[model samples]
Target: MDKIRIKNLELFAKHGVFPEENALGQKFLVSADLYTDIRPAGLTDDLNASIDYGMVCHKIKDFLEQHTFRLLETAAEKLAWSLLTEIAGLKKVTLEIQKPWAPVGLPLETVSVRITRGWHTVYIALGSNLGEKETYLRNAVESLNQADGCRVEEVSEFLVTEPYGYTEQDDFLNGCLCLRTLLTPEELLALLHKLEQEAERKREIRWGPRTLDLDIIFYDDLVMDSRDLQIPHGDMQNRDFVLRPLAQIAPYVRHPILKKTVGGMLADLEHSQKI
Candidate 1:
């Protein structure tokens, strides 16, 4: 990643814990490090191939002036999102918002809040066996793409397969997705649950057919296990339905625990059937 640094740009904005500070406003300094690959622009000698720093500075100033927040933390977080979303070719942003005139009675140089935000790659498994399964899957993809910090990068073709568990149910339409998101693992999980509920998904019967089933199979090679969520889902390797579609999109994606690529795992799973 290449660095584009903008240091200590001055701005007058209304953001503070004190009402007087918000009303009267104060001088604030903003700095940012916009991370992106500069090779294309450098080689091509084209301004169009790179993100425009001047435009980004204007955007940051405008955003800060337009909104009032109680804390610099809140302002920095929001601005970081705004820049990361609005700027093309920008992969990440490290933002700092500095307040020079602290209301503190003690002698202090300055106070600031800094934050870093960017997109992360994630793989999600999609399944629905009951009621317009295809529609549910499509809706799930669209819903995620509409989210603030999420984008649907690639989607595997839906594959019809026999029910895995609670086998008495109808066949399922299963597939996987490659997604880019800014949300942390837990935040992404919460969003998936919200989408599930919107699709009228119910969990009354274990492994039973449902309106929609969205599982976070992998999140940026992250491995986690807890009461409510698990990354590199516990049963993904054992289920052909999960691996088949996952391999379609990310054949070379290595499982954090298994040390096997998705394609390799699927091949091994298929080979075992002959034994």
Candidate 2:
């Protein structure tokens, strides 16, 4: 990843805890490092292929002047999100907001807030075994697409599969999807739980029947294990339903820990089941 650096671009904005500070306004310095791949632009000598620092500077200035927030943290957070969301070809950003005039009256050179934010690629598995199974799966996809800071990039064809556990239940509609989001793993998990609850999912039994079941299969080739969640989905390599749909969308996506491609895992799983 390459960077386009913008430093100490001064602007006048009204943002403060004090009433007079908001009314009178103050001088603030803003800086940013825009991360992106500039190789294409460099090779072609094309400005369009690269992010324009000049345009980004204007964007930062306009955003600061237009929005009023009491805290520098809030301003930097919102500004970073705004730039990442609006800028084309921008993958990540490190933003800083420096306030030279402090109301604290302590002899301080400057007060500043700096933060980094970026988008992440995630893969999610979707399943439903009760109440219009297909409908639940489709609605879940739509819900994820409409969620803030999330974009559904690809979806595999839903397949009807026999229940894996608690086998007495009905067959499920299962599939996988690729998502581009700004949310962290935990935040994404929370959103999934919210959607599941909306569908009236209940976890009374292990692998119990449910109106909806959402699992995080992978998060940017990341490997993590916590009490509530597991990346690479602990049992994905053993579940045909998960791998079948996932491979359809991302056959070459490698598991972070196993270092095996989704397609290879699916093939291995299928071969073992036969033997």
Candidate 3:
């Protein structure tokens, strides 16, 4: 990842805990490292190929001036989100906000907050076996696209598949989608649960009938396991409903643990079933 650095750009903004600070405002120093691919810009000498630091500076200044926060942490968080969303071609950002004025009786050089934020590519599997299954799956896609900090990039055609663990139920309408999001794994899982609840999903039986079922299949090649959530879903490789649709959209995406592409895994599964 290449970076365009903007350092020590000063601005006056109303952002502090004290009421007097908001009323009178204060000097704040802002800095950012805009991360993106700079090869195209360097090779072609095209400014359009790269993010413009000048415009970004103005954006930062304008954002800080318009928003008021009692904490530097909150201000930095919102500013990082704003820059990542608004600035095209920016993949990651490290933002810093420094307040030089000390309200404390003790002398201090400056108090600052610095943080890094970026978009992460994630794969999600969707399934529904209850009434209006196709409608449920489609609505899930739309809802995710409309959600903040998330964007649906690609979707696979839905497939009608037999129930896996538990039989004697209607087949499932299953599909997968690629999502670009700013949410952490936990946050993403929470959003998925919320969407499932909205669709009236139930967890009465394991892998049984449901109005909607959402699973996190992959998150940027990350491997994590906890009581609450798992990344690179534990059983995705063995499930055709998950692999087939995921392969359609991301065949070359490799599993971090198994080191196999989606297409490769699907082929292996099909072969094993025949044997």
Question: How much lDDT does candidate 1 score?
Answer: 0.93
- Candidate-wise lDDT, in order: 0.93, 0.94, 0.95
> Who wins the lDDT comparison?
3
lDDT of 1 by residue, 150-252 (tens): 9899999999999987899999999999999989999999999999999999899999989999999999878899998988899888899999999999999
Residue lDDT tens for model 2, 1-275:
89999999999999999999889999999999999999999999999999999999999999999999999999998998888888889999999899999788799989999999999999999999888999999999999999988989999999999999789888888999999999999999999999999999998988879999999999997888899888979999999999999999999999988899999999999999999
In model 3, which range of ten residues has the least summed lDDT? 98-107
| C-alpha root-mean-square deviation, candidate 3 | 1.0
**What is the C-alpha local distance difference test score of candidate 2?**
0.94
Q: What CA RMSD would you report for each candidate?
A: 1.1, 1.4, 1.0
Clashes of each: 0, 0, 0
- Candidate 2 lDDT for residue 50: 99
